[model samples]
Target: MRSIVLLASACVVTTSSSVAAAQNPAAIEHHLRYAVRVDGQPDVAMDLLERMRSYHVPGVSIAVIDHDRVVFAKGYGVAAFGGSKSVDSTTLFLAGSISKPVFASGFLRLAEERKISLDADINTLLKSWHLPESKFTEREKVTPRRLLTHSAGLTVWGFPGYALDSAVPSVPQLLDGTPPANTAAVRNDTFPGARWLYSGGGITILQLATTDITGEDFPTLMRRLVLQPAGMMRSTYENPLPMSRRGEAASGHEQIDTPVPGGFHVYPEMAAAGLWTTPSDLARWAIALAHSYRGERGGVLSPAMARQMVSKQMHQQPPYGEGYWGLGVAVIGDGDSLSFSHGGRDEGFVADFFMRPASGRGLVIMMNGVAGGLMGEIERAFAEEYGFGAPPRMTRTIVAKSASELGAYVGRYVGAAGKDTVRFDVSVAPDSKTLQVYNSAGRR
Candidate 1:
């Protein structure tokens, strides 16, 4: 909403402050209650917030829209690690795989124009390329729809990317399981139109196909079809820090030994892993999703296609159902009150988007700087708050070890003094076992 630039430390602290400021009525503190119907709302909302915060998500940006209105939008924690910048509605964040469903929406738009066919195997559209050979399966039938829905079964989470000074694979090399891929070839992992598997590589191939077929760069395509139409102005498909434009984005951090700025280095794959923007901007995208479900022309996608996008594509795991996979969005359920969502995470970033078509409620959360996998709990909280489903029960496993073994978990936290860290050391004697926490700041 505003043209603003910030340094790392200040960016992290202040961004969240603006979103959670006292003036904001729909702050993240009560995000769980935004459109959720529960027996006791206020108390439950407070507890959910506590649990989310308790999980060590340093920063979180959440947006809740109901019935075409923005019911809640708030930011939490620091956007830039060791910086004063806070999470706010205006802060830009990497939305990881969330961009996939959005990209799928673009493909659906082209399909509507009869420019492409979802059922058509993608081999025909590769500009100067074709699917690589696979000893495991036939590749001729691999379709764009299957790739978008992850049914085409391409392997690899992504390129795994080479850094600024490192050698990265070219598009074909990456797809062909060449030197950089170092794994399965670009050939179909599963027969086309079969089961679902989450493959960032599949999306990457689709990018090549989409660009070749449409004659546009990925950025131009996304902006023209999805960003502008959906009103996501503050976003872009550009992933790495644009040369000469480095300061425009919020930096990320990691907390393994100490809080380090720009966590895990930069990743090179922009299509499957790039795209950055604010929750406020994404909120509009969520609203567009809400509109699409309600028979409104929210943007690039038709209403029918929009519904198809969020439906389950494949059964990813047991108890998760044969999750609907239309286009890119992984639809988890079709309950009268809720539809499941797909979330994305990268080295230094994490994001989640939930659309409740049944109730006209949509939510998205983004965060920079992570402690560990605990960041996912917030998404679970959002679902539970809305009565979408019950949170899974976790069982902790305790192991015994020697004192020397337990002593290895020691570390000093270089972050702000108050931030707690999680570290455990294990040690034991032949007669019995012992556990010692050399350094642990955060409460578990």
Candidate 2:
């Protein structure tokens, strides 16, 4: 594969065959300064673009690294869902838990600087509040590492904010499991690190720890420790401040025919979840990670710290490969090809970051839809085009106990999710190897 390095004022970038196909050399070269390295089959990315039109993803941007350079970087869909505004590589979106790895890096930096201790019990840092006296275990022993790996046994998902009808809990009250414990956010049933539960609260606790350390506000500390150090110029921990402050951010949209309003979620717990960044800015951080791993100097973080940041801390993530959760990131795949990847889903947006450190490959994809949106599709297309894995299994097969046993499973039913009921239908097949599931409003 022939690759050309395009130079601009700020940086050098690479473009793959797909990007070169639709745009002229100058246009492709323009993006080379900041984003996109198209190295794979451009023809495959083009096919995926056709399929994305029906999903209402509106806008999409991809950055792929080929060898030492980013060879494929380009935009696929419209920048905004409402009009014909085309998206570019610089488009920004909410990073969701993708913020975790980034935030965890700050903590690791602090640890490396001898300012914080990862093995110390988090209770030592949390000055004011304390966990309840549980019969299961001593909560005082929970450390920062557990919270980082989600071994802290927080909730499976996140806590839904206090609705209009419900009152929100104070941070101390949230940890104590007082009023408005919606089961997603706070629960007395599980002790810290007893099992694997995905809790934003763990990150919130991390937020307070930083607050305690710096005594400055959360946003200010994060700006200093993370945003500034990582060279995430277009990123901020101060989310949803104003469009003026965050120049040229892409507009968020929901899964609707007409434009849906209020594309933002006011995340009180900003450290674990809240981050808005452009793909171009994020590429800086991605490249810094690669450099750190390769023992390059003047990167965002030190080489030793970077290695610790990606180390597999937990094995409980079964059915997903001794699946390892690092400080705040999930490390996937076997040795030599390990990946640090994370995905985020908010009300009106979904974002994903894929980085293969060994090969120096990274990708960022964002869409203005809810869950079940663009990342999976784009990944599938990438895999198919690159021969990483076979095309996704077209047929899904399931083995059920029996027809009579399936009777109990069939129902015009509602999921026992939470306060609200999600209606769906589940019918059993006597032939087995399949279960008919009616598409529900919940899934949509």
For lDDT, the strongest prediction is 1
lDDT of 2 by residue, 182-241 (tens): 434333356666665566777778777777766777777777777787688778777553
Q: Report, for all candidates in order, the number of backbone clashes.
A: 38, 12
What TM-score would each prediction reach against the true structure? 0.73, 0.73
lDDT scores in order: 0.59, 0.59
What 10-residue stretch in candidate 2 is worst by lDDT? 6-15
